[model samples]
Target: MSDLSKRRLKLWIRLLGVTRGAENHLRDYLRREHATTLPRFDVMAALWRRRDGVTMSELSRMLLVSNGNATAVVDRLEADGLARREAEDGDRRRIRVRLTPAGLTSFEAMATGHEAEVDAIFDRLSDNDLDTMREILTRAGKAT
Candidate 1:
């Protein structure tokens, strides 16, 4: 391969490594400090964004997970009284899931911790470094 191709390959590997490492750190942090799984946090975050709630299918699409996976998470959340399911109006078969009041409070607490954990992970990057990285990623996203 050409030098440019080799460099690009190395960049891809480095990007993937950084992404995975950060994710792993967040997962561990959430598990240890909050006694919650990352997936649960993610589901709650999505629901938090849409307080009106979302259908199971919509939640699955938002999370980019299988409907079954979304259902499983919702089931656990419902069991814990952190989430609730209500049949959609005029469509009993369509169930909408939303976070309970307790869920919202719980999520807010976890979110605060999550934000700190993420900030700590990227604390090494200066504002200029962040700007440069964002610019590069934006250009790459446009290309894709």
Candidate 2:
């Protein structure tokens, strides 16, 4: 293979490895410290961003997941009193979901800890390292 092609492949592998390792560490941290699954946390995070709430279809699209998957997670959230679903006034079939007050509080707590955990995980990287990586990733994203 050409040198350029070999370098490209190696870079891709390294990127994938880093992404997976970070995700796995986050999953373990959330589970052990918060007693929450990543998916559940994700659902709550999405809802917390929109105080007014979002339609089921909108939520599914935002999360890039299937309707069934979003519904299942929301169902669990609702059962736990972390989320509430309200039927549309004109169309009962359509429903909007929002986080409860308790959910907001819980997510705020989780977010604070999550940020700390992530910072600790990458604490070895210097400010210059982070800035350089961010610029490189931004360029790569724009290219795609």
Candidate 3:
């Protein structure tokens, strides 16, 4: 293989490794500190972004997950009083889900800790390093 092809393959592997490591660390932090799984946090985060609420189909699409998966998470959230589902005004078959007041409070606390944990994870990276990495990754993502 050409030098360029070899380097690209290595870069891909390194990128995957970094991504997985960061994800694993975040998972552990969330589980240990908040007793929540990544999926549950992700679902709450999505709902937190949309105050008006979202349909199950929309939520599934947003999370890039299957309907069943989204439904399962939502089920747990609802059971925990973190979320609620209401019948769509014009469509009885459709439902819109939103975070409850308790959910909002819980997610706010979680989000604050989540941000801190992420920051600590990359505390060694200087501001310039972050800027350069962000630019490189943005360009690479655009290529795909």
Candidate 4:
């Protein structure tokens, strides 16, 4: 095998291992807190970061989920009063989803502790290594 092929294979293994470790920690913590799954948290996080509400279609694209998947998730969030769907007067069919004030507060509380724990999970990484990892991962995401 070529040297580059071996290097790429190692990178893939490392990526999967690191991701699984972090995900498992997070999943366990969130479950203990309130039985929140990662997918639900991800949907809330996407809305949390966006100042202006995102359209349902746009959210599906951002989350790399199918439109039906996004719709089902949104339905649950709406039923829980965490999110609200607004119809545009200009286009009645277009539905934009926004987090309620309650949702914002909930996400903030959860995110604070979540960030601290996740940060410590990678505390061993040097600043330079962290930066490089973020850059590489960001590029990889764009490629996908």
Best by TM-score: 1
State residue 18's C-alpha deviation in candidate 4, in Å. 0.8
Clashing pairs in 2: none
Q: Whole-model lDDT, candidate 4?
A: 0.88
**What C-alpha lDDT does candidate 1 achieve relative to the native structure?**
0.97
Badly placed stretches (over 4 Å) of model 4 are 135-144
Report lDDT per candidate: 0.97, 0.92, 0.96, 0.88
- Please list all clashing residue pairs in model 4, or write none if there are none: none
Model 1 TM-score is: 0.96
Best first by lDDT, ranked: 1, 3, 2, 4
Query: Model 2 compared with the native: what TM-score?
Result: 0.93
Q: List, residue by residue over 49-129, the lDDT tens digit for candidate 3.
A: 999999999999999999999999999999999999999897879999999999999999999999998998899999999
Per-residue accuracy of model 4 over 1-118 as CA lDDT, tens digit each: 9999999899999989989999999988888885687888888899999857899999999999998988888898899999999986668789789899988988888898789879
Error of 4 at 87 (Å): 0.5
lDDT of 2: 0.92
Q: Any idea what lDDT model 3 has?
A: 0.96
